[model samples]
Target: MEPLRTENLRPLDVSENLWDRIFTVAPLVIIGTVEGNSYDLAPKHMATPLGFGNYFGFVCTPRHCTYRNIEKSGEFTVSFPKPDQVVETSLSATPRSGCSDKATDVLQNLSVLQATTVKAPVIAGAYLYLECELFRIIEGFDDYGLITGKIRAAHVDKDYLKVSEVDEREQLMKNPLLAYIAQGRYAKISETFNFPFPKDFKK
Candidate 1:
């Protein structure tokens, strides 16, 4: 066999936060929380399940209302919007006026439902919903903070649920999933392939 060529490799600078420079696919979720008399919904792409168990987390900044709301209420909700609902997800990020309440302005234009376990609201028509209680907040990372949550309740749309007889890929093709490509881009995930894990592998 011929030796692999590596002469073209070059060093890259890391001064500008390399993660933002790379193109990565991540789940885009709308985070919901209660703000006094109204509710707030914001789109977050830097979020994921903390581990295999029922824990979730997302990166937040102190400047955002989400961080303060979660701190005040001790709970929040996550809604996974479908591919078709991307417009609504984007709308949630609309900037609010200084004199007006952002939660009131944003919630007035969205379809939402009250969460069962938390005081937060969940987006209607979302494929999945997770009601979470504030677990811990790790701050002091420059300006961003890691907000961890313990999932208290979860809900999923019936159509997106897995079934023994149904082919997962086929179902996904019919109802494509939504993905966020970092750097202000989005994608509709309609095709997928099974990973060929080594034999004797166990979950």
Candidate 2:
């Protein structure tokens, strides 16, 4: 075989570019609810997918408040925002940014639920909610802490299911979620092309 020609393989920008790509492919919205206050951060920097097949979950490493809370409480929640809630979703990811206030201003009326296992609150209007318990906490070399949450429960909204014929595609179709990219930048699923999974996908 001929020597492989070098192409786009270049140094990854750890901050803006590298971190963003991880969140782009499979976005995860993490809600860190502690005390009476709820602070959310949808991490753009995540580890490779772990767990069993389609039932797998993306890794999340928190460097600030969320990490502190999860380290203390050993529990957290991940909620999928609805399509219409993309703006709010993006705002929630902002760490101490004023955008969070703006997003909350819009979603002030949104309902929140108490987590069964964790102190963190769940978005009542979210498409899906995962109640997670801290399984492992790996301290990274950088200013980040890798948190592995074992999903104890997965809650799907009732309104999202009108019949026995539940189609994840159809449910997600209506709520095309938001994704993190760079410094305070976001992208919508509408702009990206999607493909269906194979029939033999492991659950």
Instruction: Please give the lDDT score at residue 47 for candidate 1.
Output: 96
TM-score of predicted structure 2 = 0.64
lDDT of 2: 0.58
Tens digits of per-residue lDDT for model 2, 118-174: 777676567777777877777764655567778787777776554757556565466
Model 1 segments more than 4 A misplaced: 1-10, 97-100
Please provide TM-scores, in order, for all candidate models, with all chains considered together: 0.92, 0.64
lDDT (10s digit) by residue, model 1, range 1-203 = 99967699555576668766678999999999988878889999989999899999999998898999999999999999999898999989988763136777677888899999898899999999999999999998789999999999999988889999999999888878899999799999999888999999987
Q: What C-alpha lDDT, on a 0 to 100 scale, does residue 68 get in candidate 1? A: 90
User: What Cα-based lDDT does every candidate model obtain?
Assistant: 0.90, 0.58
Candidate 1 CA-lDDT value: 0.90
Model 2 ranges with Cα > 4 A deviation: 7-24, 36-49, 53-63, 94-111, 158-172, 182-185, 190-203
For all candidates, what are the clash counts? Answer: 0, 0
Task: Kindly give the stretch of ten consecutive residues in candidate 1 with the minimal lDDT sum.
Answer: 96-105
